[model samples]
Target: MYNTLLLLLIIPTLTSGQPGKCDQTPPQATVLTPSENKGIYTMTIDMKSKNQNIYRPDQTYVLIVTSNDVKRPFKWFMITVEDPEVDNSSYEFDHRSVDVGSLKTLDTNRQSRYSERCYNSVENTDNTDKYRVEIHWVSPKQSDKKQRVRLRAMVAENSEVWYVGENLTIELGKDTTKPLDSPPFPPVDSCNLCSEARYEVIFKGHWSRMSHPRNYPIKPDNNGYSHLVGASHSYKYILWQEGDKASPGLKKLAEQRDISVIEREIINAMSVHNGTRTLIRGKRRDHPYMFEPSHSLFRVDRIHHLFSLVIAMKPSPDWFLGVTRFELCTELGWLESHELPLYPWDAGTMDGISYESATSSTQPVDTVDRVAVGSFDKESPFYQMNLNDLKPFGHLQVRRLDVYPLVGDDCVEGINEHEGSQEQEAGSENVEEVIEEPLIQAIKQDPSLQEDNCALSEWSEWSKCAPDTGYCGMGTQLRSRYRNDRKVYFETYQDQEDFQDGYKSQANMAANCRQKQDGALIESQNCFVDCL
Candidate 1:
């Protein structure tokens, strides 16, 4: 009896001082099968984990299985615990791999392939030192969410195992039935068929005029047509899976072929939060500026409008002849009474307005007389471009195109019209449109009306008539003011030919000029005020 009492005391001491569980953690897992899954592929995995100390044959846990791939890192999720006690009803159990009808095959277990796997495995006898589970089947294809047969295992550790497979589901996607790289473009109709390189160059040539943070690319869902280089609805190009993300194949041909393609986004507009300015690229005249490959969040429908103009000039004998085309893309849904990025009045200044300031009282008229849209020859130096070699990710076939041509003073002819003269006495419009009468008609014409005519040597004596109204009077007024401002500040504008560039400079000038309190020309609070 004394020995037994000594043994009981010794047992308590040994239990308190003995080494505890060495393999208390679960095992790491590795999936070995299913390198690819498109049709009838199978998935298999080998997992190992450990548990020690108290061992109960009835204790159960679950294992979650998952995989990593290139297109998608994780695709499947499968559970290991199949005990009736573990409610598997909450799981997304798709039995597409189950055989039915004549496709059924004889199985010793008579259970569907996917439901055939044993829930748990014991290392030896009724208990297990580690768990290994495997499942096989084909995923369902009809769902829009593309829920695939993914695998992610979790073991309850008998303690943590209950919640391991709960609320775990793998997202699936449709198979790539038609692989890319099959020349997914329409049949060519013209010589050279405008290769992707040429298309990109043309797109660049026309995309540069847009000023962003004000003239951003519109979202496709936005109402109205896009007027910028690549903003139009029909202006999308193809995405040659292997080519640059900005390749012109994805844009419309007319837009991709034009000379310029740049637009602006406004940071602050009225009380509506437009976020910040983003430069959207790849838009064309009369097209919708729907999507910008560079900036994904910018949507056209969220904005009010987009404006674009293209000017083409030719040097004539008397003046520089030019054709200017203006276009606007607007929406009715988002328009409000609040101030907007000024259209032409404020936009044409090219010098004085800050994108942050919305108080400028500039109004856009229907006409813009100073700017013109012009056609260009592909061979012209302005259209000439170099290849961009260092594109990110070894993409973006950067090919430079010619900048738009700038018409000089020699090619410009100012119109002169008499005030309120409606009758066409000597009908000749501006100097650019004036036609010279034949010398023979002047010499042989009736001598009475000869009072209006002069000698062949004095052909300049004949004066042309004026129209009832001035040429786009409102437009002329606005353009004249802008031109006068630039002319008066010639010293301030050495190389400032661009309207937007000039406007930025003007914004700086206004900030520096200040009202003096004591006849002193000291700097005022304009800079600080402007910032505020």
Candidate 2:
């Protein structure tokens, strides 16, 4: 009786979970497996990113184990990444590992595997934190082709009751199919391709997360198209072309988003390579942030009507999207209003699979090439076989705004209508069609625009009694924090932002930053004339 009482007294201080559980099969007996008693509780296993359900074989991912009720935190858990191809043992009692077709010939008799993988709740900690546990699992690299791996886990509310989560199957490969590498881009219509003629045009860039939904590279921070750099020059000059090597200037712009180098190339073209024919001055406009269309005014004459422009993709690997060698004038007439998808093109300058992949220059120089939908290679960020059509990284739409004088202060070169001036096409019935610069300006100046983007920094420190005139009667105090501060102040940004990790404007990013100097910080408060 003393020995029995001593055993019960000492067990509480030992390791968690049932003892001797590490030993699978007993001498000449079957291995005992636990049963999943459900109905009263629920549990689930999920991925952290939640962007893609598919994972590359052999890659490591974070799996989150969660329960529906925070009040019932899991007291113990066991997880396994299994190859479904292998068969597990059958037991008269309902075993989830067998029901889900997993476990797969895994030897449960191994003490080391069980002792190392099983976990139990700790003392003196928030049980809620244990409710959501992150498990890092590495997938099997050599699973049979097309076979998926099943993720199985069991969570115990305590030693007496437990819940077995449904099996989550992850495809061994990136995807079953891939998008086309070279989608058939229709050739430009109207052959009258060029001449000494000129026309003012409105260039609209629609670059958004919708077009390039593949955040797998890295969720883009700047989250917008870089400034525009193009030339209104003769065919004598080429900004970039498919299957051709990218120039040093073009390469720099694609990889670094630096337009100055390419701008110099346009300047040099007039002095050396493609003289006077390169009529368009190499200038870039301010980038549009958060997917807003970037509109610019420019004129291309017949002599320099052969237009081509390149705009970089933020947080990309030497990728840019734009029109190439487009002759504004076709003998038929100016291609009035032309809208086309702007497929991403690789400068072949940087070797990377995603936007934030470490920069590794391609040696021996790779030729510029178009990005095709990588439906097969799950690793490539551009893979889109899984996405619906009509959505890509971006698209370009240009409409003739009006005819420009051969020699004018504007319209002959690339320019941003910063003054919010928009020239409408003459004889056009649709006046509202032209992007109302005034509306954009008003939106920028309007405080209401804050709601969509106006997120506040974490609540500021509560302030002390105000009315310093004498903190005694009818006094009030308030604490304030920043809103849209990242783009408005905390930094020098008229439009775009660049951060090493990512560029999305988030409240957390500016939690410690303030716009106190610029008057962008907004205070939240409530006060009454009558005070205690």
Candidate 3:
């Protein structure tokens, strides 16, 4: 009665181009489960829909569903394996979004196992488990209302796995009101300190030839696992002894542990050869590591001994690749020594030979292959170390330690904090002159001194006088003035043979070479020479 001429208009829900399409159902899909193992595997799913009026065949759709974890605690979903179907027209294809609507409803468990952008390996590969899939309407629709649908399907093995539902009901039925309750998620394994420990498997085998022994790295099998190899050489006794040899009683342990055995010959050359030693000048009179407190400091009287271990690849060593390990023994037990601190240790590819000094202060364990040794000069703090300061078996122990002189005794005050002014004064007064006043003046004029003509040539008398840090060319700077006066020598060559045989004695000379009008040849001959 109140609206005799009233008129009403109703708007229908619209899709991309059509209206009143909210009642349409979406098609189902087929899903496959991961393989049996819990490492890394893949699964596939297929979607199908023929309701052109409700769901367009040309229009693309996304599918997502909840994960089934109660059946397999270790199982995880990998989105990378998804491959959607493309239509005949290159312009159109089916796509899926993982998190929305019914798919979100199914995954209400709230415990997501996937790390953002991080890949996880699936242990199982079989396609027998059920997975959720959702369809999203992405194109611009005529209606303001959004449309989405979801369904669950089991992936068939190998065959064309596809969606299984005739069509998903979009209405808010009793099924929509009651959510499917999923099982609680299991606790993930989280080992903090355990994760820090590096556990590796090594495989050592000939890569190219079988008859000859050689080592090479190979890809892991279907499983993602690799074996590290041990490098053996013939140069050093330690490596030679440990080559291809396992710990004395490790056979049983090897059987129990996850180990990879690479059958290849160690091709390092330094193991099969000997290293040479060299002489280096020290900053102080005594060798750095052996310098006495009362000794004078100068390069002429301090010759540091240095040893070297040169390693080279027989044919050529692969620097970018290859693996090696070290071992150590202690009162507690045997432990795998950490990899040598020499990062990027390589030969042949990097350089044919590698160098290690004896003064390196590195501790020695059971065996050292391709290892180098060296000594420090008097200028090194270790040069003056006493037995008490040198720990023998502790962590600070050095098996092949060496010293090198870096500064002169003139800077002693800067390096040593305990010098007393009173002692300095006393030393200045008591120190006797090694060279006679007349001899010093004569040597200064001639620039050389002969053992026979030396003013002070008696051992007792010379030693009792001020320290005579003899000449560097050919004399024991510390020798008693008369004892083998010319037994010492000097040279810059690093070869061991050059300094071993000893310098030619200058005791027989009649006059100082420096004083002679023409004694250049004699002075040249006095230099230390390499035997070879």
Listed in order, each prediction's TM-score against the native is 0.18, 0.40, 0.19
Ranked candidates, highest TM-score first = 2, 3, 1
Tell me the number of clashing residue pairs for each predicted model. 97, 15, 74
Model 1 C-alpha lDDT per residue in residues 1-532, reported as the tens digit of each score:
9999999988755343212211111232243222223312222322112221111111111222322223322222224222221234334332322211011112331222231222221111112222323332222213333222233333322322221222332322334332111112222211111111000101111221242222222331331212222221111211111212222222221122322222221111111122111212322122233222110111111121221122111110000111111111112111111211111111121211221122322233111121111102222222111111111110111111111111231232122212121222122123113212111100001113233222222112211221223322211100101111111121111110112211222223223233223222111111111112
Residue-level lDDT tens digits of model 2 in 1-532: 9999999977664433322222211212232344454433432433333546555433345455566675777655555554444444222222223222222112221211233222221111222235555544444433444756556555555545544533322433343442332222323432232223332333345555555455443444454455566655655667788778998888888887876577566544432113223222212333344355554434454445556778887677898877777666553444566666666788988887766667788887788875534323445655433223335555566666555333332333333212111344343335335433210000011223244454655644544434423224544544445565234322111111111111112223344444344444435344433345
Model 2, TM vs. native: 0.40
Off by over 4 Å in 3: 1-70, 73-344, 348-409, 415-532
- In the order shown, the candidates' Cα RMSDs to the true structure are 26.6, 22.6, 27.5
> Model 3, poorest ten-residue lDDT window?
435-444
What overall lDDT, based on C-alpha atoms, would model 2 receive against the true structure?
Answer: 0.46
Candidate 3 per-residue C-alpha lDDT over 282-384 given as tens digits, one digit per residue, 9 for 90 to 100? 1111112211111111111111111111111122221111222122212221121222211111221122121111222113212222211111232222232
Q: What order do candidates take by lDDT, descending?
A: 2, 3, 1
State which candidate, 1 or 2, has the greater TM-score: 2
